[model samples]
Target: MRTKPVSDEKSQRKRFLSGNGFVPFILRRLLTSVLLVFGVTFISFSITQLVPGDPVAANLGQSAYSDPKIVAAFKVQFGLDKPVPVQYVKYVSKLLHGDLGISLSSKRPVLDDLKEYFPATLEIALVAVFLALVVGLLLGIISAVTRDRLPDQIIRVFSLTGVSMPAFWTALTAFYLFFFVLGWAPGTGRLAPGADPPPTVTGLYTVDSLIAGDFSTFKQAVAYLLLPAIVLAIYAIGVLTRFTRASMLEILGNDYVRAARAKGLPEITVIRRHVLRPALLSIITVAGVAFSSLLAGSVLVENVFSWPGLGQYAYRAAVGLDLPGIMGVSMVVATVYITMNLIVDILYRVIDPQMRDAS
Candidate 1:
């Protein structure tokens, strides 16, 4: 009786310990990300300050200098007169409180500007990422399985073209060929000019349209989204296809794959059951990294399409020397990249039991 009770207690303790281990792992990842965000913000702020130009004068406009008193007051207001270290500290402190400061050019709060634009960018990026994953994975698998056949050759050519083309050039050429020449899609804007803008529930036009049960508006929104999404998908497809092909090739050569073949398993079953899962692990990793680039790369695509998104905002900000806007966009991009990488790290354990055990 005593031995039985002791064994039960020991088993419960082991289970408890095993379950609690993930708590620390999650907490550590979150803590590390917070530190990283601060570090990136500091570096970004420092670099912008060090860049050649007077941010204050630029912010105040050239005409503000007509009055010497106004120029002095403007510098004092923005703290350009303060030591660089002091300014950095103040900027970081404000950032931690969700105040990104005001854009020098637009004279609007950075957070407010981001709030206005980030949703459209995110909607486009999400659609593009989804398409990239589905198409890239399928093409990669087909190409790898088909080996040196026509399908493989075609996919390779597509991937190479995607990789080699610059995004702006691709966007411009795509716009010209598809919109200007073919006239299959709208030339610019998120919707047809006369179409009623849907109510903003989630700030995503597609989702909002669906919620309103307006199929016509939803269809229009989706159509407007396609060109930019396809442009974004071009680069992602190339990257993911290469990774998936490499991973699939390695998995195909694994012992388990050979054993499955030896066991006379159906070819499809062996490929799907023993090969694809392991191959997908690497592909997932690549997809996560690819997602980080989508937001940044959307700049040219957004500009070409006249989509009101963060990319367009960032472009205008850079051209106009909107320091606050630039900083806000950079911070958002950095945060997104860091978050994606962290999610990927966590997913590694989930996808690979070996990784979970090792952790």
Candidate 2:
């Protein structure tokens, strides 16, 4: 009787694991991300400290750098004169309180600045990722379905060109053709000159404008967003296309795919339910990596387009030797990267039953 009860309990536990056990997976990812964020903050802070320029001097500028008393007072005020450990403790403490420090350039809080600019970068990145996924997956599936044919050759060559093209060059070329010559895209900003932006709800013009029932503002935002979005997507689209094509080709030749075909399944149904589902593991991995990379790559894209975004802000901070600004941007980027990786890991667990079994 005891053995029977124990067996029933074990079965219940097993069922729970198979059903709701992903909670532990999510917790593990969150815990691991916390550690990574700490490490990023520590390492980035240390390296910025080691950089030759003095923050006090940078903030004070060339004139007051010669004034020892002024410099000393400035360092003390900013806690730069404190020991490294003390400074780190204070910095981390402020970070925990949602204080990202002050941007010496704009005389604004870094958190406030990020709140203002992050949405623009996010808008572009999200659009770029969407375009990449749609175009890339379509091309990849077409290439796989028509393997070794002219269409496959054309897609491979096109993707190769995209991978090889320099982002800066592409940005400049697109700007010239689309904005300057053709006048299709708006000139170098997130809004047309004198065109009013939507009310500052989420800082995302498209959604915020739509929420406010402002179709005119939404249309303008989309026009301004399209060029940079396409430019940012070019590289990611190439990578995802190649990865998806390779994965799909392999899956299309699998025994199950052949069996599905032999069982009189429609080719489309077989590819969709059998081949594509199995191949999504690779697609998800590529998309996650691509999204993270696009966040970093926004620096160049924003610069070229003069978009009022975090990338431009980060670049300005670096040029002015603003350590707080740099650290804030670095931390944000690191958080995004780690969070995306965690999402990808969770997805892998979902897509591959073997991962769940192993856990």
Candidate 3:
């Protein structure tokens, strides 16, 4: 009787896993994420170690580098005195306890620095991605509907330009044209000069200002965010426009879409109901990936604009040969990519009936 129950339980559990039981699905994903993070740590640590530079010398500078005792103490402090394998073992140990160690340049805990800088990156990335999605979708739908028309040709040219232009070059041009020539946009940073930041609730200036009912700061924050967000959105906009146009074109040629058109449906109605609805899945997947890329790829834009985000931090870390800082940034970026992909996968499974059934 006990053996029968055990076998029945085993079969039930197997069925649950096979059919996407919520708990088991989430647990399985969590396990995969943990393994991926583990692998990222090893890779990041190894790559950071391979970067040629004396972190101790860089941090201590010429004067301090002459002091043997100081250099030896510094090496011992950051585990540079130990062998590579030993250092990696210690790093993994500290990582398990949530210790990212101290930045050789900033002399602050890497995790703490990440916490401070990540919010800025997240804010810009969110705004940039939202802008990309809206503009890209509109342009894409217009281009598809007006295929071979003037508008389509113009949008295609614009998409090509956006795709080809480097972000730093675009940022400099935008900054110069708007801030200096036209004087339309504010300069860099999250807030304007002499403006006090709103209370720290979400660590995002715009969000926190809105929460604190500070309209003036919120407006200024948006103004400061606009140029950089636009710059960051350019590449993603190009990619999404191309993807959406392709997806829309494919959907518009489907039998149901032709049937709707043949049934005397309005062009707008046919495009919206028949074309866009089916193309949303692919658009969402691309958007999620683009958002993660924006988060990771904003270094140059952030540096050009003097935005105090993770990208800027990473730049400083690399320039100063801050191993812990570099490792921390790498891990955070890797986690963001993995997390975005996981979210997309979950959404795909939830939205597509075939995927859910097959799972």
Candidate 4:
């Protein structure tokens, strides 16, 4: 039996991405995501309602908390006087109109707060994902190539430690070791003390600095970001390394790979053209998941590093019992998670003919 030619595979991928089914596939995913986001709103709102503190009391002073008129007025102002269901309905209604509600602690709209901090998180997460892909793929390929050997065993142990360690614990350890012991790492925040931030083109200091040709700010931004990004990437790196190893191990045994090797092709060429290409589908999926997880769950890392990202914003909201802010963060996280999965699905249809045919 012969495999389809390379040209045929390319054509199939092209058709899958540009063909009639692509629109419907995207539509289905969008619909599903919208529904999931709606459900998330309900759950987030309900969960915030159960937080063990009074938002009014948290925002107001102890003396103000005893003032019934001020408390009643505060509740009314925030729509906290309404039933949970009614509040949820109103929240969703306002959400559809692009209102994320005012944060009780900050007295600012939650959307504004997210806008202020989200870029920091996005910058760090992107850097971490890039690092994870590079290091994980390299380590994985090495481990698979050196299967059952000392190198593979060492990598396996490293991967296990990376995945098993709690992110906050790793973050704290890294912080102390680098900042206090080694004195090589920049300590916390997006820049050094009194450093003038770059002009806000994208709200990401690294990007904005480059755009403005300010290499000084860019260097400081990267220095501060490095340790935290690495800490954030540890788990993703572990997961990706293990996953890539498994995928490569499976594909390495395929007939095409064996045939390519038998054809007197260079070892690197055979691995690249045959083994790695087939394994990319799995790698892409896991990478998307890892990046999304980094975005949603980097709260402890952000807190440890004092990185003013969405995670830190969420932490503050939760601590202050800022219902609107908590719900806003939840919606953003849930939406991001669902969106990443949808993107992975689209890549599947684009890369894999079997998935396209099934669709």
Model 4 residue runs over 4 Å out of place are: 1-20
lDDT of 1 by residue, 172-243 (tens): 999999988999877688889888979988888999999999999999999999998899888998988877
- Writing each residue's lDDT as its tens digit, candidate 2 over 38-144 gives 99999999998898986676677687888899888877766778899898999999998989878766778889889988999999999999999999999889988
- Candidate 4 lDDT by residue in tens digits, 97-142: 9999999989999898988888999889889989999999999999
User: What TM-score quantifies how close candidate 2 is to the native fold?
Assistant: 0.92
The predicted structure with the larger lDDT, 1 or 2, is 2
Please tell me which model should have the higher lDDT, number 2 or number 4.
4
Per-candidate RMSD vs. true structure?
4.1, 3.5, 2.7, 6.0
TM-score of 3: 0.93
Please write out the lDDT profile of model 3 over residues 1-359, one tens digit for every residue. 12234467778877656546567787788789989999999998888878888888789978889999989999998889999999999999999999999999989999999999999998999899889989999999999999989999999999989889888899899999999999998888888778898988888999999999999899999999998999999999998998899899999889999899899988999988778977878988998888888975699889888899999999999999999999999889999988988888787767667765663
Predict model 1's lDDT versus the native: 0.85
lDDT of 1 at 40: 88
The TM-scores, one per candidate, come to: 0.91, 0.92, 0.93, 0.90
The 10-residue segment with the lowest total lDDT in model 2: 1-10
Model 1: how far residue 62 lies from native, Å: 3.2
- What does candidate 1 score on TM? 0.91
